[model samples]
Target: MKIVPSSVQLLLERLRATYTAEEARLRLSRQAERAPERTLRSAREASSANISSLWRQLGAAGVEIAGVEQELADQRTLEQAERYSGNIEAMVGTVKLPVGVVGPLLVNGLNAKGLYYAPMATTEAALVASYARGAMVATRSGGVTTALLNEGVLRTPGFKFSGLIDAGLFVEWVARNADELKAAAEATTRHGKLIALEPIIDNDIVFLLCRYTTGDASGQNMVTIATDALCAKIEQDCPVKPLHWFIEANFSGDKKASYIGLITGRGRKVSASTVIPEALVEKHLHVSIDRMLAYGEMANLGALLSGQMGAQGHYANGLAAFYIATGQDAACVSESAVGFTRMERREDGLFVSVTLPNILVGSVGGGTGMPSQSAALSLLGLKGAGHGAALAEVTAALCLCGEISIMAAIAAGHFSSAHEKLARKR
Candidate 1:
């Protein structure tokens, strides 16, 4: 299916003239300035003095030293420091962020079917307030409906061959010996099961896209380990030995946005939708349905023009905050943020929906074991096993709330003013 509908494409083409040349000029003019050349001193020696010296160097470089060392040290106990062994390299200290709660956000989904107070960790002001407003509107309008559509984690390992014929034979061998490969992959992990192995040939390279269902975990590392074992077995048994092979072929769209991920999905595929009454829209957002829909159309046009993989307003904002708060892999947000947002006019009100194909989140692994993150997950009652689906659903709903709120703000011409009033600290 085409990501952007034909009707919307035609509409954008027709309205292309409305986009002023000055606006294009301003956008083209905006560029990043070059940074000053300076190297911060660091030592391999782990000592208080070395750390202090680094901080002093930063201070000398005109950086604000906001007692970050003291605050991080205050939170870090010896036990907590021990816990950071595998999670960090050359452990310095932990930075604390202000976590805000937005809730009583009612969600009606297959897994998430209750009122959840989602904790968002961020420094951006008014973010929590904006989501809270949308949540309130959704709750008042009969709650957001969500669904866990599909779930799988992928890791593609590539094998290099001398020519197309060798690669073709290898692909045939992989297709015929699926059972053996599955057994090899499954042997590495108890919870993760090898669901499918698709072989794609590119001239002399053959990429085996291995998909897995990781129980209650995001499964980046899990899939890598499993795929590694599978590759080892392939190397040992396959008659047509490859010239070389690598664990990751960069075809799985790990930690990066890709059209394949948008289509096939890399992680938990989820969708959330809610209807806001026209009266509620005006009451809360101070915008009419007509204006909101118009703005949404313009936003969609902008997304298409910018070559965005999926059309949506700020999925990263909610995903990033939620991931950090709930101990998810924050880097996964790159792919996780790819989604489609639809806002259509309804008889009673406006129907807003968000479909996120890549929501890489888990309630059991990674940072979920951390004390602060665990507490945050517990706050939403989404800690430990059997709650991964619910966590994904809640994440989709949270993103839906953000989409509604931001679209309304932009339509009502309150986007900049709200940021100025709330974000700027005089």
Candidate 2:
């Protein structure tokens, strides 16, 4: 479609004074017409002929707009590509847990006293056994608790910025100096939400990650612009220099992190009498359980895992389509797909868990307001109050479960026949 005509532009300029970016895009397009220029020319003519014809039309209309319409078409083409890139994640299979592991699960399921959801139910199985065992080893010495901290969502105005800033102060300033932040936000034609997190862990560097919830369509552009602005501000205000900054992590561009999402918790305690026999470890788990135990290795030592290795689950492709059809900030999925699994040996048994910090899931706002996403959320029974943190926890659990299942099968030498067998006609 052609850009709005000058007369239409005058009308829209007045209306746009109050329009949001999304609204403006729609209004402008609605008022525009596809002036698909055609010219009588020999087949040998160059492609530039289309541009020349479009320029002639605008020139006759007394509009002084720059560039031929083809250029505008090219610009939009690039933008469209950028918008989907973040949502289009790579596909790696799901990883499974080791074989024959068993244990108790102690999730530090506490909260700010009055919050509604905190239940630590135990799911007994080979997988749960391994997780509980690992937890015991990690906490054998004592004080091995898992805490759930949530850095919730923040809304962004329809504006764009280009700079760095301390996210803590930036958000605080947004709160204390609402007038100024609002003014800045109102100045741009773009805006989105930003989510920041600071790990409660100590000794190690603080983890500052952010997720920008771009409303409707892909939010890649909006997030990039907003973060650039925020980062610029932080660089100017904060005293401590940031070691690194990224727009996307884990895979979904929507999920970014200051550092890698890691597993950090005390190893559980395991009693010698309760420990899985060393022979069983090598035979079933395929790992040297005896050596790990003797190395004075905290039986509950933490494990660093890789991406999905066995199961075929959600990939970047499905997520992108899901985001598009649902109206989510598709790019956030980049950071959301960094799936991982962790294992630690516990006195009672080995602990196995999965962690995916890049899970950019939501049930309200934008796409959640759409019919399809709402239906999907309802199907999962997550419609009412679950937010970002709950999704992250669940995704992490899924990864860990996969790990436990995979490892168990591998140790038992059953993974191939159980999950990976491809049947053929006899």
Each prediction's total of clashing residue pairs, residues at least 3 apart in sequence or on different chains, is 0, 73
Tens-place lDDT digits, model 1, residues 1-426: 799999999987876676676876776684656455777766654345545676678778888777875765554433365554445544455778999999999999999999999999999998998999999999999999999999889999999999999999999999999999999999999899999899999999999989999988998889999999999999999999999999998999999999879999999999999989899999999999999999999999999999999999999999999999999999999999999999999888999999999999989888898778989999999999999889999999999999999999999999999999988852
Residue-wise lDDT of candidate 2 within 1-426, one digit each (tens)?
Answer: 768898998987888688888987876685435564643332222233433444555666666756534444353333333232222322111111222222222223222111111112122233333333333333232212222333223222221122233434334444554344333333342434443433211222222343444332233354446545555554565444545544333222224431333221101101111234344455545656434333323222322233232122233433343344334556665544443334457764554443443345544554555433455444434453434333333323333333433455444555455432322221
For model 2, state the Cα shift of residue 403 in Å.
1.8
Please list all clashing residue pairs in model 1, or write none if there are none: none
The top-ranked prediction according to TM-score is 1
